[model samples]
Target: MHVEPVRSGAQKKEFIYLPRQLYRNSPWVPPLWMEEQNGYGRGKNAVLSDNEYELFIARRAGKAVGRILVYIDRAWNDHFQSSDGLFGALDAEDSEDTFNALIQAARLWLEKRGMNRIVGRFTRWRSSGGF
Candidate 1:
Protein backbone atom coordinates (compact mmCIF):
# COMPACT_ATOMS: atom_id res chain seq x y z
CA MET A 1 0.00 0.00 0.00
CA HIS A 2 1.05 3.59 -0.64
CA VAL A 3 -0.05 6.88 0.83
CA GLU A 4 0.36 10.13 -1.04
CA PRO A 5 -0.73 13.71 -0.70
CA VAL A 6 -3.66 14.76 -2.82
CA ARG A 7 -1.82 16.84 -5.39
CA SER A 8 -3.77 16.64 -8.62
CA GLY A 9 -7.29 16.90 -9.91
CA ALA A 10 -7.39 13.17 -10.55
CA GLN A 11 -6.22 12.37 -7.02
CA LYS A 12 -8.65 14.88 -5.58
CA LYS A 13 -11.47 13.24 -7.47
CA GLU A 14 -10.42 9.89 -6.14
CA PHE A 15 -10.33 11.26 -2.60
CA ILE A 16 -13.91 12.44 -2.99
CA TYR A 17 -15.18 9.34 -4.70
CA LEU A 18 -13.55 6.57 -2.67
CA PRO A 19 -16.18 6.67 0.05
CA ARG A 20 -19.02 6.31 -2.42
CA GLN A 21 -17.54 3.10 -3.72
CA LEU A 22 -16.74 1.83 -0.24
CA TYR A 23 -20.15 2.54 1.20
CA ARG A 24 -22.38 1.94 -1.79
CA ASN A 25 -24.00 -1.21 -0.45
CA SER A 26 -24.35 0.01 3.13
CA PRO A 27 -26.71 2.40 4.91
CA TRP A 28 -24.54 5.36 4.05
CA VAL A 29 -26.11 8.37 2.37
CA PRO A 30 -23.62 10.18 0.25
CA PRO A 31 -23.55 13.91 -0.02
CA LEU A 32 -24.09 15.67 -3.33
CA TRP A 33 -21.06 15.31 -5.61
CA MET A 34 -20.53 19.02 -6.00
CA GLU A 35 -20.76 19.54 -2.26
CA GLU A 36 -18.06 16.99 -1.66
CA GLN A 37 -15.82 18.64 -4.24
CA ASN A 38 -16.36 22.09 -2.83
CA GLY A 39 -15.60 21.03 0.73
CA TYR A 40 -12.05 20.44 -0.36
CA GLY A 41 -11.95 23.38 -2.73
CA ARG A 42 -10.23 26.59 -1.75
CA GLY A 43 -12.67 29.10 -0.25
CA LYS A 44 -15.47 26.53 0.02
CA ASN A 45 -15.20 24.99 3.46
CA ALA A 46 -16.24 27.61 5.98
CA VAL A 47 -14.98 26.10 9.23
CA LEU A 48 -11.72 25.14 7.66
CA SER A 49 -11.51 28.23 5.50
CA ASP A 50 -8.52 29.57 7.38
CA ASN A 51 -7.34 26.37 9.04
CA GLU A 52 -4.31 24.22 8.50
CA TYR A 53 -5.08 20.92 6.77
CA GLU A 54 -3.85 18.29 4.34
CA LEU A 55 -5.59 15.59 2.35
CA PHE A 56 -4.11 12.21 1.54
CA ILE A 57 -4.99 9.30 -0.73
CA ALA A 58 -4.12 5.69 -0.07
CA ARG A 59 -3.59 3.15 -2.81
CA ARG A 60 -3.00 -0.57 -2.98
CA ALA A 61 -2.19 -2.46 -6.16
CA GLY A 62 -2.25 0.90 -7.95
CA LYS A 63 -5.85 1.64 -7.08
CA ALA A 64 -7.20 4.20 -4.59
CA VAL A 65 -8.61 2.47 -1.53
CA GLY A 66 -8.65 5.04 1.26
CA ARG A 67 -8.56 8.78 2.00
CA ILE A 68 -7.90 11.01 5.00
CA LEU A 69 -7.77 14.66 5.97
CA VAL A 70 -5.58 15.77 8.86
CA TYR A 71 -6.04 19.20 10.33
CA ILE A 72 -5.30 21.48 13.26
CA ASP A 73 -7.90 23.79 14.66
CA ARG A 74 -6.14 26.60 16.50
CA ALA A 75 -9.22 27.69 18.38
CA TRP A 76 -9.89 24.20 19.62
CA ASN A 77 -6.31 23.87 20.68
CA ASP A 78 -6.32 27.18 22.51
CA HIS A 79 -9.50 26.37 24.32
CA PHE A 80 -8.42 22.90 25.30
CA GLN A 81 -4.78 23.77 25.93
CA SER A 82 -3.53 20.91 23.85
CA SER A 83 -1.93 20.52 20.46
CA ASP A 84 -4.04 17.66 19.21
CA GLY A 85 -4.23 16.87 15.56
CA LEU A 86 -7.58 15.80 14.19
CA PHE A 87 -8.52 13.77 11.16
CA GLY A 88 -11.70 13.75 9.11
CA ALA A 89 -13.09 12.53 5.80
CA LEU A 90 -11.53 9.16 6.50
CA ASP A 91 -12.59 6.15 4.44
CA ALA A 92 -10.95 2.87 3.59
CA GLU A 93 -11.31 -0.61 2.19
CA ASP A 94 -12.14 -3.53 4.48
CA SER A 95 -8.48 -4.33 4.81
CA GLU A 96 -6.74 -3.84 8.12
CA ASP A 97 -3.49 -3.11 6.33
CA THR A 98 -5.06 -0.32 4.31
CA PHE A 99 -6.70 1.19 7.40
CA ASN A 100 -3.48 1.06 9.40
CA ALA A 101 -1.49 2.62 6.57
CA LEU A 102 -3.92 5.51 6.24
CA ILE A 103 -3.89 6.19 9.98
CA GLN A 104 -0.11 5.91 10.22
CA ALA A 105 0.24 8.45 7.44
CA ALA A 106 -2.07 10.85 9.21
CA ARG A 107 -0.21 10.36 12.49
CA LEU A 108 3.14 11.09 10.90
CA TRP A 109 1.76 14.18 9.23
CA LEU A 110 0.44 15.43 12.53
CA GLU A 111 3.51 14.50 14.54
CA LYS A 112 5.67 16.54 12.19
CA ARG A 113 3.52 19.54 13.06
CA GLY A 114 4.23 19.13 16.81
CA MET A 115 0.91 17.57 17.70
CA ASN A 116 1.33 15.05 20.51
CA ARG A 117 -2.18 13.60 20.45
CA ILE A 118 -4.69 12.71 17.75
CA VAL A 119 -8.51 12.61 17.70
CA GLY A 120 -10.76 11.97 14.76
CA ARG A 121 -13.37 9.97 12.81
CA PHE A 122 -15.30 12.98 11.58
CA THR A 123 -16.39 13.50 8.00
CA ARG A 124 -15.53 16.56 5.96
CA TRP A 125 -19.05 16.98 4.67
CA ARG A 126 -21.40 19.15 6.74
CA SER A 127 -23.94 16.40 7.38
CA SER A 128 -22.31 12.99 7.42
CA GLY A 129 -20.10 12.51 10.47
CA GLY A 130 -18.79 8.98 10.13
CA PHE A 131 -17.64 6.45 7.58
Candidate 2:
Protein backbone atom coordinates (compact mmCIF):
# COMPACT_ATOMS: atom_id res chain seq x y z
CA MET A 1 0.00 0.00 0.00
CA HIS A 2 1.16 3.52 -0.79
CA VAL A 3 -0.11 6.85 0.46
CA GLU A 4 0.72 9.87 -1.61
CA PRO A 5 -0.24 13.52 -1.85
CA VAL A 6 -2.65 14.25 -4.61
CA ARG A 7 -0.77 16.33 -7.14
CA SER A 8 -2.31 15.55 -10.45
CA GLY A 9 -5.68 16.29 -11.98
CA ALA A 10 -6.38 12.58 -12.07
CA GLN A 11 -5.51 12.16 -8.40
CA LYS A 12 -7.71 15.11 -7.49
CA LYS A 13 -10.63 13.53 -9.28
CA GLU A 14 -9.99 10.25 -7.50
CA PHE A 15 -9.89 11.98 -4.14
CA ILE A 16 -13.20 13.70 -4.77
CA TYR A 17 -14.98 10.62 -6.01
CA LEU A 18 -13.60 7.92 -3.71
CA PRO A 19 -16.54 8.19 -1.35
CA ARG A 20 -19.00 7.37 -4.05
CA GLN A 21 -17.21 4.12 -4.70
CA LEU A 22 -16.70 3.39 -1.02
CA TYR A 23 -20.34 3.91 -0.13
CA ARG A 24 -22.01 2.61 -3.22
CA ASN A 25 -23.78 -0.30 -1.60
CA SER A 26 -24.64 1.51 1.61
CA PRO A 27 -27.42 3.98 2.30
CA TRP A 28 -25.17 6.95 1.79
CA VAL A 29 -26.36 9.59 -0.62
CA PRO A 30 -23.40 10.96 -2.49
CA PRO A 31 -23.01 14.68 -2.93
CA LEU A 32 -23.54 16.29 -6.30
CA TRP A 33 -20.51 15.78 -8.55
CA MET A 34 -20.27 19.46 -9.46
CA GLU A 35 -20.52 20.50 -5.84
CA GLU A 36 -17.69 18.16 -4.92
CA GLN A 37 -15.57 19.49 -7.75
CA ASN A 38 -16.28 23.09 -6.80
CA GLY A 39 -15.34 22.51 -3.20
CA TYR A 40 -11.79 21.76 -4.28
CA GLY A 41 -11.62 24.62 -6.72
CA ARG A 42 -9.76 27.68 -5.44
CA GLY A 43 -12.10 30.10 -7.17
CA LYS A 44 -15.21 28.40 -5.89
CA ASN A 45 -14.26 27.84 -2.26
CA ALA A 46 -13.60 30.64 0.19
CA VAL A 47 -12.04 28.18 2.62
CA LEU A 48 -9.43 27.16 0.10
CA SER A 49 -8.55 30.82 -0.32
CA ASP A 50 -8.21 31.34 3.44
CA ASN A 51 -6.70 28.11 4.63
CA GLU A 52 -3.77 25.83 3.87
CA TYR A 53 -4.77 22.35 2.70
CA GLU A 54 -3.59 19.18 1.03
CA LEU A 55 -5.41 16.27 -0.50
CA PHE A 56 -4.08 12.72 -0.41
CA ILE A 57 -4.85 9.45 -2.07
CA ALA A 58 -4.01 5.91 -0.96
CA ARG A 59 -3.29 3.20 -3.43
CA ARG A 60 -2.76 -0.56 -3.18
CA ALA A 61 -1.63 -2.63 -6.10
CA GLY A 62 -1.76 0.56 -8.16
CA LYS A 63 -5.45 1.08 -7.46
CA ALA A 64 -6.85 4.02 -5.53
CA VAL A 65 -8.50 2.79 -2.34
CA GLY A 66 -8.70 5.71 0.06
CA ARG A 67 -8.49 9.48 0.29
CA ILE A 68 -8.18 12.28 2.84
CA LEU A 69 -7.93 16.05 3.03
CA VAL A 70 -5.78 17.68 5.66
CA TYR A 71 -6.01 21.38 6.36
CA ILE A 72 -4.98 24.20 8.62
CA ASP A 73 -7.72 26.68 9.19
CA ARG A 74 -6.15 30.00 10.10
CA ALA A 75 -9.44 31.33 11.36
CA TRP A 76 -9.92 28.37 13.66
CA ASN A 77 -6.47 28.76 15.14
CA ASP A 78 -6.98 32.48 15.63
CA HIS A 79 -10.43 32.14 17.09
CA PHE A 80 -9.49 29.49 19.62
CA GLN A 81 -5.86 30.52 20.04
CA SER A 82 -4.75 27.00 19.29
CA SER A 83 -2.16 25.52 16.99
CA ASP A 84 -4.33 22.72 15.72
CA GLY A 85 -4.72 21.00 12.39
CA LEU A 86 -7.87 19.49 10.94
CA PHE A 87 -8.70 16.69 8.54
CA GLY A 88 -11.82 15.70 6.66
CA ALA A 89 -13.25 14.21 3.47
CA LEU A 90 -11.94 10.84 4.56
CA ASP A 91 -12.98 7.93 2.40
CA ALA A 92 -11.32 4.58 2.76
CA GLU A 93 -11.71 0.91 2.20
CA ASP A 94 -12.73 -1.27 5.14
CA SER A 95 -9.14 -2.08 5.84
CA GLU A 96 -7.34 -0.99 8.99
CA ASP A 97 -4.04 -0.69 7.19
CA THR A 98 -5.49 1.65 4.61
CA PHE A 99 -7.12 3.85 7.25
CA ASN A 100 -3.95 4.07 9.34
CA ALA A 101 -1.78 4.95 6.39
CA LEU A 102 -4.12 7.75 5.39
CA ILE A 103 -4.25 9.10 8.96
CA GLN A 104 -0.48 8.89 9.40
CA ALA A 105 0.03 10.80 6.19
CA ALA A 106 -2.32 13.54 7.37
CA ARG A 107 -0.65 13.65 10.78
CA LEU A 108 2.81 14.04 9.35
CA TRP A 109 1.69 16.83 7.08
CA LEU A 110 0.07 18.66 9.97
CA GLU A 111 3.06 18.19 12.25
CA LYS A 112 5.37 19.54 9.60
CA ARG A 113 3.25 22.69 9.56
CA GLY A 114 3.74 23.15 13.36
CA MET A 115 0.34 22.03 14.50
CA ASN A 116 0.28 20.76 18.08
CA ARG A 117 -3.06 19.00 17.90
CA ILE A 118 -5.15 17.20 15.33
CA VAL A 119 -8.92 17.33 15.03
CA GLY A 120 -11.06 15.72 12.45
CA ARG A 121 -13.95 15.47 10.03
CA PHE A 122 -14.13 19.25 9.98
CA THR A 123 -16.38 19.36 6.99
CA ARG A 124 -17.14 22.51 5.04
CA TRP A 125 -19.86 23.98 7.29
CA ARG A 126 -18.22 22.95 10.54
CA SER A 127 -15.00 24.65 9.60
CA SER A 128 -16.85 27.93 9.05
CA GLY A 129 -17.59 28.25 12.77
CA GLY A 130 -14.09 29.52 13.34
CA PHE A 131 -14.72 32.40 10.99
Candidate 3:
Protein backbone atom coordinates (compact mmCIF):
# COMPACT_ATOMS: atom_id res chain seq x y z
CA MET A 1 0.00 0.00 0.00
CA HIS A 2 1.02 3.60 -0.61
CA VAL A 3 0.65 6.54 1.74
CA GLU A 4 -0.50 10.00 0.70
CA PRO A 5 -2.23 13.04 2.05
CA VAL A 6 -5.93 12.54 2.57
CA ARG A 7 -7.40 14.20 -0.51
CA SER A 8 -11.04 15.04 -0.01
CA GLY A 9 -13.90 15.13 2.44
CA ALA A 10 -14.80 11.61 1.44
CA GLN A 11 -11.18 10.60 1.75
CA LYS A 12 -11.14 12.06 5.22
CA LYS A 13 -14.07 9.86 6.04
CA GLU A 14 -12.16 6.96 4.63
CA PHE A 15 -9.27 7.83 6.94
CA ILE A 16 -11.65 7.66 9.87
CA TYR A 17 -12.89 4.35 8.57
CA LEU A 18 -9.52 2.54 8.25
CA PRO A 19 -9.47 1.34 11.84
CA ARG A 20 -12.60 -0.66 11.23
CA GLN A 21 -10.73 -2.84 8.79
CA LEU A 22 -7.74 -3.17 11.14
CA TYR A 23 -9.54 -3.70 14.40
CA ARG A 24 -12.80 -5.38 13.47
CA ASN A 25 -11.65 -8.77 14.76
CA SER A 26 -9.74 -7.46 17.76
CA PRO A 27 -11.01 -8.66 21.12
CA TRP A 28 -10.57 -7.46 24.73
CA VAL A 29 -10.29 -3.82 23.66
CA PRO A 30 -12.79 -1.47 25.23
CA PRO A 31 -15.42 0.49 23.34
CA LEU A 32 -14.31 3.95 24.53
CA TRP A 33 -10.77 3.42 23.32
CA MET A 34 -12.23 2.52 19.96
CA GLU A 35 -14.19 5.77 20.04
CA GLU A 36 -10.97 7.75 20.66
CA GLN A 37 -9.45 6.23 17.56
CA ASN A 38 -12.43 7.35 15.50
CA GLY A 39 -12.32 10.80 17.02
CA TYR A 40 -8.60 11.41 16.40
CA GLY A 41 -8.76 9.87 12.94
CA ARG A 42 -11.02 12.76 12.01
CA GLY A 43 -8.65 15.33 13.58
CA LYS A 44 -11.20 16.36 16.19
CA ASN A 45 -8.72 16.47 19.05
CA ALA A 46 -8.57 19.82 20.85
CA VAL A 47 -4.90 20.37 20.01
CA LEU A 48 -5.52 20.16 16.28
CA SER A 49 -5.66 23.34 14.24
CA ASP A 50 -5.57 23.98 10.53
CA ASN A 51 -2.30 25.91 10.60
CA GLU A 52 -0.34 23.34 12.60
CA TYR A 53 -1.52 19.81 12.06
CA GLU A 54 -2.35 17.81 8.97
CA LEU A 55 -3.32 14.14 8.61
CA PHE A 56 -2.66 11.57 5.91
CA ILE A 57 -4.23 8.24 5.07
CA ALA A 58 -2.80 5.22 3.28
CA ARG A 59 -4.64 3.33 0.63
CA ARG A 60 -4.22 0.47 -1.77
CA ALA A 61 -6.16 0.38 -5.05
CA GLY A 62 -8.32 3.19 -3.70
CA LYS A 63 -9.07 1.39 -0.43
CA ALA A 64 -8.03 2.71 2.97
CA VAL A 65 -5.44 0.64 4.80
CA GLY A 66 -3.33 2.80 7.12
CA ARG A 67 -2.76 6.37 8.35
CA ILE A 68 -0.25 8.87 9.82
CA LEU A 69 -0.47 12.40 11.10
CA VAL A 70 1.88 15.36 10.65
CA TYR A 71 1.76 17.89 13.40
CA ILE A 72 3.71 20.78 14.92
CA ASP A 73 2.08 22.19 17.98
CA ARG A 74 3.23 25.73 18.68
CA ALA A 75 2.51 25.44 22.35
CA TRP A 76 4.39 22.20 22.58
CA ASN A 77 7.44 23.72 20.99
CA ASP A 78 7.17 26.84 23.06
CA HIS A 79 7.17 24.86 26.25
CA PHE A 80 9.85 22.41 25.29
CA GLN A 81 11.83 24.88 23.17
CA SER A 82 12.46 22.18 20.65
CA SER A 83 12.23 21.77 16.91
CA ASP A 84 10.96 18.23 16.94
CA GLY A 85 8.10 17.45 14.55
CA LEU A 86 5.66 15.09 16.17
CA PHE A 87 3.93 12.32 14.27
CA GLY A 88 1.74 9.46 15.36
CA ALA A 89 -1.69 7.94 14.77
CA LEU A 90 0.08 5.20 12.90
CA ASP A 91 -1.99 2.04 12.54
CA ALA A 92 -1.52 -0.68 10.00
CA GLU A 93 -1.44 -4.44 9.53
CA ASP A 94 2.19 -4.76 10.64
CA SER A 95 3.41 -4.70 7.04
CA GLU A 96 6.89 -3.29 6.61
CA ASP A 97 6.23 -1.68 3.25
CA THR A 98 3.04 -0.07 4.47
CA PHE A 99 4.77 1.26 7.57
CA ASN A 100 7.70 2.60 5.58
CA ALA A 101 5.49 4.54 3.21
CA LEU A 102 3.65 6.11 6.11
CA ILE A 103 6.93 7.03 7.78
CA GLN A 104 8.28 8.54 4.57
CA ALA A 105 5.18 10.66 4.16
CA ALA A 106 5.51 12.04 7.66
CA ARG A 107 9.21 12.60 7.15
CA LEU A 108 8.65 14.60 4.01
CA TRP A 109 6.03 16.69 5.71
CA LEU A 110 8.31 17.44 8.65
CA GLU A 111 11.29 18.16 6.45
CA LYS A 112 9.22 20.67 4.53
CA ARG A 113 8.49 22.37 7.83
CA GLY A 114 12.22 22.54 8.68
CA MET A 115 12.00 20.05 11.52
CA ASN A 116 14.92 17.65 11.79
CA ARG A 117 13.71 15.66 14.77
CA ILE A 118 10.68 13.40 15.22
CA VAL A 119 8.95 12.46 18.47
CA GLY A 120 5.96 10.20 18.55
CA ARG A 121 3.81 7.35 19.88
CA PHE A 122 1.28 9.99 20.93
CA THR A 123 2.50 9.92 24.50
CA ARG A 124 4.78 12.00 26.70
CA TRP A 125 7.52 9.42 26.06
CA ARG A 126 8.61 7.59 22.95
CA SER A 127 8.00 3.90 22.43
CA SER A 128 10.74 1.60 21.17
CA GLY A 129 10.02 -0.51 18.13
CA GLY A 130 11.30 -1.17 14.63
CA PHE A 131 10.61 2.53 13.94
Model 1 reaches what TM-score against the true structure?
0.88
Tell me the TM-score of each prediction against the true structure.
0.88, 0.90, 0.77
Give the higher-TM-score candidate: 1 or 2.
2
Top candidate on TM-score is 2
Runs with alpha carbons beyond 4 Å of true place in candidate 2:
123-131
**Models sorted by lDDT, best on top:** 2, 1, 3
Residue-level lDDT tens digits of model 1 in 36-75: 8898865998657877888999888899889989888888
Candidate 2 per-residue lDDT, tens place, 1-96, comes to: 999998989888888988988899999998999999989857788877788999989999999899988899999999999999988888899999
Better of 2 and 3 by lDDT: 2
lDDT (10s digit) by residue, model 3, range 38-69: 55533666666433767788777876778887
| Candidate 3 local Cα displacement, residue 23, angstroms | 1.6
Q: What lDDT does model 1 reach?
A: 0.88
Question: What lDDT does the true structure give each of the candidates?
Answer: 0.88, 0.89, 0.74
**Largest lDDT belongs to which candidate?**
2
